[model samples]
Target chain A: MAKDDDTAFDQAGFDEALRRRARMVEAVLRQVLEQRPLAGEIARPQRLIAAMQHGVLAGGKRLRPFLVMESAALFSADGEAAARVAAALECVHCYSLIHDDLPAMDDDDLRRGQPTVHKAYDEATAILAGDALLTLAFDIVADEATQLAAERRAALVLALARAAGAGGMAGGQMLDLQAADAPPDEAGIIRLQAMKTGALIRFACEAGAIVAGAPAAERERLAEFGSAIGLAFQLADDLLDLTADAGTMGKATGKDAAAGKATLAALHGEDWARRQLAGLVAQARALLEPYGAHAAMLADAASFVAARNK
Target chain B: MAKDDDTAFDQAGFDEALRRRARMVEAVLRQVLEQRPLAGEIARPQRLIAAMQHGVLAGGKRLRPFLVMESAALFSADGEAAARVAAALECVHCYSLIHDDLPAMDDDDLRRGQPTVHKAYDEATAILAGDALLTLAFDIVADEATQLAAERRAALVLALARAAGAGGMAGGQMLDLQAADAPPDEAGIIRLQAMKTGALIRFACEAGAIVAGAPAAERERLAEFGSAIGLAFQLADDLLDLTADAGTMGKATGKDAAAGKATLAALHGEDWARRQLAGLVAQARALLEPYGAHAAMLADAASFVAARNK
Candidate 1:
């Protein structure tokens, strides 16, 4: 383990870098949600645009976009291309949040301390906004402006679609719903979490490799790193749900426990969960050791995920 | 302009072709939705997969897929490639229908004489099913099985995203919801219809040219043909709503007028709408004149759109 002084230095650098990338992601997203219609578009409906903005522009840590940027930096990918892809990933993230917060889903009234999209705009508009955002993610990736080659763009689309589709996020959501009636065992919980959250985080890291045209070996390592951090991210989240308040989280916490959803954190107790998170973070860092200092920021990111309080 | 005998012959050929393509699309979709998960997928949740199949496998005209196949035939595109693209397009169409039938949206309980997705499954399952289907459309398009070049695949994804995004289908849904509160004028109605219904139809035609690698001029012409027929399809639908009963339509009829929504056929009387439909079909047929007999099936499709009773 590092000394306190070295850890402090790394924390400061990581905080600044995360904030910088978050701001960049915010700017790109703001521009993407502009009312001005793109070529071949008929017109942007104001109500829908406003709803999308409401769901997306609400502040969060923007950790997923940060992962994409830092991971891409490992291979020296073009910053502009990575930024756009990061924005696209954020769009998908926001879309899932909006849909998940629907009355039929998680039924949360607040997100990031503001009214959810359905509460801010009617349910119909919220649904449309989410749909549009998801569609726009693919649009952003495939558009010429992303600056990647056509093959790379198509590969990205395929990867994103797989991550977000039936056997991934949406399927995992169904599993979560089912778990309410019959909670799954440890393996089931792992699979459910992997599909629900792990898939997108893995994609975010792997997207960097794809954008940089990194070799398959590097991509695999980055993806493994993503999986490790993704596990840590979820474990930390479950811990926060148990330990943090709604005011701190800016959304409802303790609901997973209330709903009786099976989680590793809930199953194994806090001490075990914390120790596991530390191990996962270490594993994530080791996966990037081949890139040495070039991957220092990503290694720091793994620590941040394990250590985040909110 | 054709004699009664020639018209009968053309209609017979067109009907058989449409059925053949519809069956082909159904087979492709069934295979895509199999219980076996794809590469990188953790697992295919049975409930979600069943819901998707419920939404997609229910019978309909499959006109959109037929349009894709016929349009691709115009450019002599590979049959298998066109079939996959046609199946992908149908997925988007089914997703929109599933969503549109939600309680917060159109609220229809029935589609094609069967329960709507939300009725057959729960509202949450319906939403996830629609989301998964939409995501799968891109997956199918970007997958190697589509057999298109990388650039072409990227182009297809971009085009599909635009046609389905905020400024197109979802945007149009917003406009339609607003129209319920404050009905739009004729121009607004046209724009709404174009975005909601016309955009996808146009993409269906244009995708054929894209799959075949046809030149820009031909692509534009096919798109125009799609627009003409799209207008015809909506007009015929409105006319059917006014004239046909719920039983004939296999779903609710006259709901548009009941909801006080503005439509071209409702704006003008039946005679005027019929005249407009005739004129649009003529325009559509004329646009395909360059293809001569090779365009015969597509031209028949325009006539069918105008003349269909349901």
Candidate 2:
């Protein structure tokens, strides 16, 4: 591990890296969604495919995919494999957002400054689109094109399923919904946020570790790094909701508070929340310190999550 | 292959076989759902779990799982592995039914003689429950407990995803919803039914072959067999919908004609449909003849599907 004093971390370099990886992910995702494997068996339903295209092709920063790439880089995992896995993560993330934006859930019409899937399409289309995307994520991970060893792919599929399934993201969303009825304590809120958003983020990092065939200790450490940063990401998000408007955030702001949902930022004041975010980021960086320059980008990721405007 | 004069297929034997397999699938599903893997990470979210339980535990014939096990039996696959895989197929089947019964889709109040998931819970819960069950299906198949080679599991995951995703069940559903605006012709309706219902049923059979490590030709043959029975199953369902009342069918009857949906029975009349069904059953049975007495239950299954009252 190189000493910190060897070289300063470059924020611009990290941004460029993120942009390059995001483009790779975008291209892969386009090719993936373009596939009509059952061409002769069933004519691909145009409207459903159109809705899926609408749901997935809508752009975001692709932060989670970037995390996947950077984490994989720590062990020099295959770039194509990492990219495919990252795409899977992004699909699950996007699907959750679509479901969350439904009238029965967050009821949001806007996402990424455009109409949510349910708004752009009807309710049933939105529901099907989300469901299809979720299924597609697993499909991508298990695809032969991803080109990992079978066991490794199975491991990826298992970890991903757990992260995205009832025990992880979906369960977390359920808790979030129930919180609206009876607001949870601060601990409950943290647990909910951890499951709702953090679980996937954590999986993104652990996924890289799995892809890289890292040892158990290393995998655990990277996962811990992810958990810290996951918390930091959501905390930063809560802070932004309090501070930013729709124009800057590209979605409704302060809806969490309006819904009377307890958040760390809501429970604590802005100053304390800001301090907590810094602490979490620092903790994340320290966890990555053993990898030194190999983890420089990941350190930047934590900082970026804390500092992003949107 | 068995000769025509070899032996008579027994209806009673088939009924007992169906009952036995259904019971095995039900037991496995109950155990699978009882799991609380993330107990420490998050509270299991009882309402969501309950909704999932309600959706899956509501009694049905377990025909899909039976197909999975029976098809696997031809290759003498590991019984436990087949059972687990069958459970996963059942999860997908139940999830689809749950979503299909939602107010946004079928608006069904009763399913299997009880209030639908949405009716028993709420629209949001129903949606989430369906989503969770779908996720759980993949999880179970991907799990090490299934004990297949990782490559086989990956194949199963990929196949299941395609069968359940845009090119298959969900896409078929979108088309079904749109059919209300522009009712399809016979070919179009057949295509839609093949995808919407037949895809998963086909997967159940193909999954069995995959589990048994059957060759490509055998897998394709079983899949074709699945397609034949899939059509027969829908034809039977449509016939029952036309003939049976809510008391026997356990849900509203004749809703398809009311919705102006074009089923074979609706388009060709009951007599033509019955003849088509018998022909399909004969076709399904013929496909299994090569397996001899080993396929007696399957041949009986085909006849049973045609003759079923509900």
Candidate 3:
């Protein structure tokens, strides 16, 4: 998506635009998982598929996949490529959330205003659900459902896998667990954010662009857009943790403070973090300008970055 | 594999082959997963990669991946297909082993005569390791490091995913946990065996041929080879629980009986299970002959099916 600064566009109108696009993502995901009926009883491993669908359907704001779709639209590519990549991206994102909410990790009992996977099912099923989602993401790719060429599809799969695997979200998770004792200094936070949040978002954009057959420079530009917006999204999340209500968010409010968890509010102080967040949103918006007209939706997404309460 | 009469091959010779082939599986698996030094502070996810490697490397008979390789060789394919599929199959099988050994499931403290994954590390790390391995299996296909065609790669991914997912292994697990009060019917036994053991072995053999560009009929033949052997493998396992020593088997014997777990031995008595097992092995061995000269190695594997303890 050409990342235009949507500060010039209708703010409410752009917000509405994103909501529409978000709906598209949900529709696409449901479409891809639609299968013919099965006969007899399903075996064990197959249970993971249903478990994955259960967790994913529990709902969250479809941001990562939205990013891919928005970015693909910015490139003037049809929604076909964006739709496929977005489904896979959502699978990875949903898997991460499920594992992160497990009893042994953050121990979250709720997400998006619903019971966590562990609470809804048991821990073992929750574990398998996460594992299945991770596996299913690649299954979707290796299924050749993507609109890209085979090599490009492979590239997309590799991108998502590497990001989600030991070096990416998994690495971030471990680091976050270790860092719970003391918030890392600036570099540590950056490294943590890079792995935990940046990798998948970056991959989402790049994979979508690859699907759209974007030129090398365009792919790089989309990546730049992804990194900036991705960080901004997390910064906003930190702010929301301190400011949003639990009921509104459908999650525990200020649980970070309750658990003595480290946050931007604790480390940088609220004012400084908010100021830095504003700067991040601005940088994110600026990154969209090069995509010209194509970046309208992305620019609006950036604008929303500073304002979303939950 | 076809159902066979009691007379198929020399039982004594076959036992030696299972022992020998199991060693080859171990060697092949170890050779692929050897650690290469990483550049930086290997992230937490990377640690999972290490943990997965460590857990998988801790060793078993390497039977599943070996089955894949040997079944592939039934088509006279080269080493490359066998080796790659071996790695892929091991990733899925070992991932299952890790999850199966978790605290929330069987709550076992030992595996392969060593600490189970949760005991080896923390429960969280073990969970992540299993998750990583499952993802890595798909990543292997998504990365498509081998010379497989796009369509073939997709098929392998779907097959493996389905094999390892709900209808395959996961479904079996659910049945296991949920079917504790289930009546000990013959169909119930067959259902459990198909999901728990039948799925991955079938995937392994079929994947090898799919990767080797084998024809559809031959792939079906390979699957039958896997199916008959898989059923036999489980039966043998049930039998060994009654007859084998801990030192030789490398696991705590009599635990199934102690746990009151249902097994062929529990239902049909040890003697009947044995006769049934011999018949299965003969049937397993016969499935490979259709490959003719290309079938020798697979026939050797079939012999190994029951020869291990004969």
Candidate 4:
């Protein structure tokens, strides 16, 4: 482990890098969303665009986009391509948040310390906004402006679709819903976590490799690294749900426990969960050891995921 | 105009071809959905898959897939590639239906003569299934099996995404919702209908040319054919809502008027709408004239869209 001085320096660097990448992602997203599907005769509805912007521009931490950018950077992919892909991933993340906060889903009224999309807009607009954002992600990634080879772009699109689709995030959400009736065991909980959150994180890392046309071995390692950190992220999230307040977290935290969500942290006690997170972070760091100081940022990211308070 | 005998022959051929393509789309969809996103451990939640199947396989007309197939055939694209693309389009269509039928949206209880996905399953399941289906469409089209150049596949993904995104289907739905409060003029209604239904239809025709790498002029003409037929289809739909019963249509009819949707058929009398439909079909058929007999199926398609009883 790094000394306190080194850890603090790394943390500051990570924060600065995260904020910079997030800003870039935000700018790219704004530019992409500026495009209209029909330009000449038909115009984009102001209200729908407003709703979409509301869902996306809520100013969250933008962790997923950060993951995408940092991972892509590790493979020396084009910065523009990485930013475009990161923007696309952020769109998916924002869209999922909007839908998940709907009355039918998590039913939360708050996100990112503000009113949720469904709360800010009507339920219908919220749903449409989420749908539109989801659709836009693929569109942004596939655009020629991404400047990736056609095959790489296609691969990225396919991976993203898989990550977000059934058997992944959506399917895991279903499992989470079912857990209300009958909570799964630890293994099932882990599988659910892997699908629900881990899949996208894994894709974010692998996308870097695909965009860079990196070796398959490197892709696998990066994916594994992402998966480990993803698990660690979820464990930390569950911990925060137990320990943090709504004011800091930007949303209701205790709801997961109240809803009887079968999280790994719940399955194994808090201390055990913390240990697991630490272990996973260490494993993730080890995965990047071959890249040396070039991977210091990713190593710090893993630590951040394990240590984040909100 | 064709003679009565020729019309009958064309109609029969069109019917046979449509059914054949629909079946093919169904088969491809089933095969695609059979593969789990996480094969061994996470396992696709059977319930979510079931809900998706319920939404998709409930036996609608599959008109969109038919259009895709006929259009692709015009370019002599590979049958399998066309089938895969058609299947992807069907997935998006089915997903839109599932979402449109949500309680917060159109609130329809029945679809395709059966309970909607939300009615058959639950609202959350319906939303997730719809989400999964939408994600799955991109996955299917971007798959290696589509057998197109990567750029073509990327283009297809981008087109489909645009057709389904904020400026297209979802945005149009928002406009339709707004029309309930303040009805749009005739042009507004036409624009709404074009975005809501015409976008995907146009993409279906254009996708064929794209996959085949056809000339830009050919793509534009096919797109025009699709747009004309799309307008005709919507006019026919509005007329059916006024004329048909729930049983015949396999779902609620007359709901659009009740919802105060400002459709062209509602703006103009049914007779005028019928005349417009006829004009649009003629225009659609004329656009296909350059393709000669190779476009007979497309011409038949235009006629069928205007003439579909349900």
Candidate 5:
């Protein structure tokens, strides 16, 4: 759907790259837990460490964090520094996933075809894992990637916090609950989509650019790309929730209808949902024209948004 | 139960003072939030701001943030700076409250005479509210406060994140779940409380002093005060869960009995629980001796911790 150019993006290579990147992220994040002055390390109590590792390591598309690394690579003098920036985004993303999978939230039993964190461990462990990941996101930025200006880095952390926070994903989620049963027109749906998905995606792209010291103008452009991609991502997701079967999608498929969700299927119908997704993908791709040579991976990543089946 | 020092502390005034302090904390928090960029501020379409405000101001003890401001005041700081620090702690405390109220964790319906965040709003809002509060806590700390040193303030922010995140309160919560219906022992109970309760309390005191530029060596002494009061506070909470009526408590009471939780009461019986509370109160009060004249309010606060019916 996002294929503006005829050249096929390396889907296989991108998948492979994401997997490798996720492993590296897990390695870096685990290093945080392992560092010791034992008593000084905030009393992790063995079990907590196990639970966190279990959730964070469970496989999924490590898209946002990968974008963090990739976007940083656009300007970072050091490749390793870019990787660390990437790792920070992973922390934020993983925390969000942990919360999203909780019994009280999305209530999914399966994530990435494995037991959701709450199912793999317990609800409390899942909550802690999410909290740890969220805090550790800032800790990593503060401790490892201080190459950015102190105030600026603080701003980046703040940016991530605001995006992933109550007003961002959390707020979006609340709107989502209301939109499911309440009357929300197209604008309301768009607003919910922007927050629930766009906030983090924008943060990921912006964080990358922020760390590498991209100009405000370029950063804003990248943020636009992120927001566009985020909307397309959700359009695809709502479509998937309706169309994908359990065997292919891993989780409970078509649960959206049962839940009475006002998804894309309900609003635009299947054909129009597909058409709207394609249009968003085109717009997302168009935003990348200025980044041109620099944003190849991000462009590829964005283009893949509506095209990917799962 | 801690009334052995009844002549030393005033219950009514302290309660009233605490209430006044809590309201002040909430107001200051609202002011700090206004500093955020309006573009990214919560959207009205989602009713995100309303949900965020509701979760936070739904009435809490605000003790931790109060400790932050009070500790800062002990060093003769500007009133505005102290208010910012106090409000930051309240943000953290409120986040924890929102998450704690979720069905996945403590599963309570009421908090402070109102419906829990999840109940009044929805599960998604409650999660976001918690996430938002946690994120905003760091945002406040990282933003420029009038008199704080960047390095020292950073240390305090890092400390709070550690305490609030995976390794501290979160880790404790995980352990709390793991310990449920398993076994009851003194060491286990202590570990649980220290993580769940002690972490935030310790940060509250230390963050205040950090902002005020208390010498690093002085932190150890203040930490002792925090540690003692933290335990006493938890003990008081556990006891309240056992003895307070639902009407007076504003939530379901005797929940420990219903859930068969492992508190000191569940572990050692009510007689042993009271005796242990007495011991902790003495230990808590003893740690404040060095504060001299100013310790009266702090000490009074500790005694009030013991005497509260709910």
Candidate 6:
């Protein structure tokens, strides 16, 4: 384990760490979205680049990236490489948000308390911006600056692609869109949530292991930990959507309910959902127990994910 | 050169070869887009998959894939590997087409004589399908089935990403969208066409070299050939758009002039565009001259691209 892994976990400490990592990710993303074009590129359209920056630079907890960083730290992975991977993951996350907020999808005007990409720019720009951001994620991972071995870099690309592709996040989005016409049953909702949100979060943790060249056993363990936290994250999100106001959430809340989308948290009632979150956080922490002190930050992350208000 | 390189490059032979390679690419693409989800995926949403198939499986010449296959053949690369790379390039190409046909973009209802994805399905499905296809392209390249060294796979991913991302195809699309409001000058039109269409074509030829583990000089040569052909391809396309009817082109034509979007061919008139095309084909063939008989098919391809009626 890295020396940094010995840091004690506390609510304030975890929050501070999350913010710091968000800043790190933001800095990397800002550079990635710079005005100058890369080699083999003709020119970067100002409107497209501006739209991409608007979608990605908006503030959030950067929870997914935090998971990548902390998970990598547990495996003693290179911090710089982990940061790039985190930023790449965040790009995928942000791109999905941009697309999901398009008029044909969720159709929201506000995101992170600002006009969504489609609202700020035209719909065509927003679509292209999202496409470009998604492509840029792979570019970042496969670039030499990530400083990983060729094999590790290839593995990262494969894993990230799977998590973000048809059978994963995008597929999940498709299911979510269908949910309005035919609300899913409990099992279907779980599957939808797992694919929609869990896959990327799982990849975030697994990416650390891939970057560190950790053993398969360790990779699987981190992945399982990720799965637990992923469920908890979604359940918590659904819970917030049910109870929180748009002002508190920064985006519109109660959207799932309005769309008649069935969520486990909504279906089983808030009480049951809270209990599930508790169990999931516990399950997530337990998976990390084998790592002892090195897992402290990850353990804190699970709790934070479940308990975050917005 | 392999034994296959000895074949004569008559028009019939070249057309047959192109069609053969297109079939190979289509087969690979079909398998890649199958209903069965890959590992780590929860489920493949049916509607999204169908929409993706509708977008991709619609028949075109598969010119980009053909370029990749032929370029790889120049270096004696594995045929199967080349085919996979070809399919991946086609995915990016198809994704761009799907998104570009959206109401917010080109607003076209027809593509290749069939209803566009958004017309056949809804706009949301079309968007998701495009997004998924783009993501799947990287997934296909990075997969072990490509049977390349990890370093080569990573390079392919990097190159493909750069070609398809903000500074390349997507960036070009943005510029093309903006062209209606502010038509580009001659130089600007060249840059826009290069990014929007040339980047992927360039990547296609360079990919064969990358897959074959060809040396830098060889790669550069193929890339330059690609550039020459790419410009020729766009010029030919612009000419056709100005002269051909929708019944012949199988999609809208003369839209560049209608939309007030400048193209070199449209700006300079038919005679100049034809002269430029002839020069570009000569330049392309000259780039491949060192390979002698081995590059005969590619030489033919340059002429074919510049002279194709549709």
| Candidates' RMSD to native | 2.1, 3.5, 4.2, 2.4, 3.9, 4.2
lDDT of 6: 0.90
C-alpha positional error of residue B205 in candidate 6 after TM-score superposition, expressed in Å: 0.7
Task: State the TM-score of the second chain for every model.
Answer: 0.96, 0.94, 0.85, 0.94, 0.90, 0.96
Q: Give the candidate number with the greatest DockQ.
A: 1
Give per-residue CA lDDT, model 1, range A29-67, as digits (tens).
Answer: 998899998877888899999999998888888999999
Please state the Cα-based DockQ of model 4 relative to the true two-chain complex. Answer: 0.65
lDDT of 3 by residue, A1-310 (tens): 1233432346687767767766777786676454431221244333455566778876776778778888777767768667767877888898888888988888888787778888888888887777666666776665655556666666676677677766667777766876777767777777787778888887776766777778988888777777777777777788788777777777777877776667665678878766776677677777777667777677767656656777
Across B1-310, the per-residue lDDT of candidate 5 in tens digits comes to 4355532477778878788778778787776555243345445333556666777776777888777766766666555666677787778777787888788788878878888878887777677777767877776766664345556545666677777776678777777777776754888888888888898888777766777777876566667677777877887788788777778887777876777678876666667767676676677677667777776676666676666677
Judged by TM-score, which candidate is best? 1
Q: In model 4, which residue pairs have backbone atoms overlapping below 3 Å?
A: none
lDDT-sorted candidate list, best first: 6, 1, 2, 4, 5, 3
iRMS of each prediction in angstroms? 0.5, 2.0, 3.9, 2.4, 2.7, 0.7
* Candidate 2 residue lDDT tens string, A244-301: 8778877777888787878888789888888788788888989999998888888889
Tens-digit lDDT track of model 3 for B1-310: 2224443565555556656656665564555444441221225434555677767878665667666666666656655656666777788888888888887777878777788877877887888777777766666665555456666666676788778865677667766765565544778778877887778877776777877778988888778778887777788778888778778766678877776678876788877877777777677667766667666656656556655552
After superposition, candidate 6 runs with Cα above 4 Å error: A1-9, B1-9
In the predicted model 5, the residue pairs found to clash are A132-B166, A166-B132
Residues B66-150, model 4: lDDT tens digits: 8888888988988889899999999999999999999998898987678999999999899999999999999998888889999
How much is the lDDT of residue A142 in candidate 3?
57
Candidate 1 stretches greater than 4 Å from native: A1-9, B1-9
DockQ of each: 0.89, 0.62, 0.44, 0.65, 0.42, 0.84
Model 3 CAPRI rating: acceptable
Write one digit per residue (lDDT tens) for candidate 6, span B27-84: 9999998989987676899899999999999899998999999999989999999999
Show the lowest summed lDDT stretch of 10 residues, model 5 chain B. B37-46
TM-score of each model, in listed order: 0.97, 0.95, 0.88, 0.96, 0.85, 0.97
TM-score of chain A of 1: 0.96
Error of 2 at B17 (Å): 1.8
Name the candidate that leads on lDDT: 6
Candidate 3 segments whose C-alpha is farther than 4 A from its true place: A1-11, A28-51, A76-81, A145-148, A181-183, A245-247, A258-260, A263-265, B1-47, B76-78, B181-184, B245-247
User: Candidate 3: lDDT of A228?
Assistant: 77
